[model samples]
Target: MSPLVALVHATPAAIGPARTAFAEAFPEAELWHLLDDRLAADADAAGGLTPPLRKRMLTLIGHAVDNGADAVQLTCSMYGPVAALAGQLWDVPVHGSDETMLRELGWSRPARVGVIGSLDSAVADSARRVAEVVPGAEIVPITAAGAAEAASSGDAERLSAALENAARGHEVGVFVLAQYSLTPQWMRLEAALSTPVLSPPQLAAGELRRNLLEAP
Candidate 1:
């Protein structure tokens, strides 16, 4: 039987890449999307994660739990700590979208980590996650200027072009796409650079598959 994995997303942009990852990497696992754009709006309004924000995240996890999700993953990279706490609370495999990527990069011990994100908050959040895994790692945060707007406007070409531009001229072991919306440009970004690209959606999907389907 296929395990059901619930995906909690703070923005609409994460949905497509997440769904695509599930289809491409682990189609046997049923995918469920729980989107709350207000989560992002409120988080932004508050300037950071607050106690109330934590509670709200827990509530979303609870919803996934009630729906019989065998595992839950947040498509939003900014909520890494919240997802960690949720994993403790739920006794299930709870994961932040970029956690797997962070772990991989940490093991690689890259001296200069490159991060590309659609929003400033995402860039900061991803950099912090990278620091957590690889202490004192030099992080270069680059904003995919106008990429968020292009994504929201449903202009894939424009978003890809913007991310491609933002990712160029970076010398690092790997470039991390801080937002799932940027995953579609992973191959192009890899081609443009001399390093590999780490995609949150792909990594998260593989993590879920490893924990659920491949766990022995």
Candidate 2:
């Protein structure tokens, strides 16, 4: 059987981009999506990841594992840390949304890294993780104003513009899109700003394939 990769999404906007990423990067893997639309809203309302929210995330992950997922990827940056805990509990591989992206950034050892996200919490969380992996680099957290709304409404132009405006003044060695929902806009943002842009989904998909599908 093809390796089944479960993608747990905190918001609906992430589903399409993730599917596209996996399709391109690891087409042979079977993809399963589990979305909890209210997850992002609750986390935002709580101002961060609360104990209950963490438990809820674990429960969702546990369900995915129980349902025959060979590997699981959390698509929400805010809930990323939960993936670590899930990994300890489950035998299969578990990955946070930005793990591979942050790891690669650390490898590059960029002087300054810009992290762009549609939501403040997601940006902050991603920035925190980036700092953990690349302690020496400066982390710039850029919250693209109105980007969440633009993404939810499927306004690609507005989303791209918001991200570009937020990124314009920042002089960073590399820019990372901190949210899976924002991945689709990375290419256009990179072109407009003339800077290297990194997003999580594609990188995560490739990593999963290398570890699970290609490994002997």
Candidate 3:
């Protein structure tokens, strides 16, 4: 049997595209999307990444590992810290979605990096990661005006617009589409923002390919 990649999805909106990306990128491996609204909803419910959210995510990670996932890709940008905390519990490596770009998006000029998301915590955390990798870049996090309702029901247009709108003002923008569900909106939002959008799925897919190919 081919090794299966365990996709732990934080938000329902991101689950579909994340699995899609997994399929396209790692066709040799089976992809499993285990969606958890509890973790994401807690962050949303709290208006950001709170301790409660982290605690919830930690529990979810354990559950995924117990179920026999070969590798784990956590599909949340804001829950970076939670993912980090959970790395010790499982035998398989746990990857954070925002880990895609590393510090490559950072710059010394203090460029404004807009981390737009439906959840306040994701936006804030993605910004910090940008700042960490790129020393002087400024991070501006804005929530989509009404994306949660739209995304839950599968409204791609609204999600795309939300990404574009969140990135409206930056001169040297790097938009981190925090969720997998928003991946389909890349092209549409790219036309509107004209800013660099860093997607987690494709980036992770690339890494996964290399790792798989190089595995002895």
TM-score versus the correct structure, for each prediction: 0.95, 0.97, 0.85
Model 1 per-residue lDDT tens digits across residues 28-63: 998888988877667766766889888888899999
Please give the lDDT score at residue 73 for candidate 2.
93
lDDT of 1 at 16: 87
Evaluate residue 192 in candidate 1 and report its C-alpha lDDT on the 0 to 100 scale. 67
Those runs of model 1 whose alpha carbons end farther than 4 Å from true positions after fitting are none
Q: What are the clashing pairs of model 3?
A: 14-181, 106-134
Query: What would the TM-score be for candidate 2 when compared with the true structure?
Result: 0.97
| Top-scoring candidate (TM-score) | 2
Pairs in steric clash, model 1? none
Q: Which candidate number has the best lDDT?
A: 2
RMSD of each: 1.3, 1.0, 2.6
Q: lDDT per prediction?
A: 0.84, 0.91, 0.71
C-alpha displacement of 99 in model 1, angstroms? 1.1
* Candidate with better TM-score, 2 vs 3: 2
lDDT of 2 by residue, 1-216 (tens): 899999999999999999999999999999999989999989988888999999999998999999899999999989888999887898988899988998898798898999999888888888888898888899999999999999888899998999999999999999999888888988898999999999899999999999997899
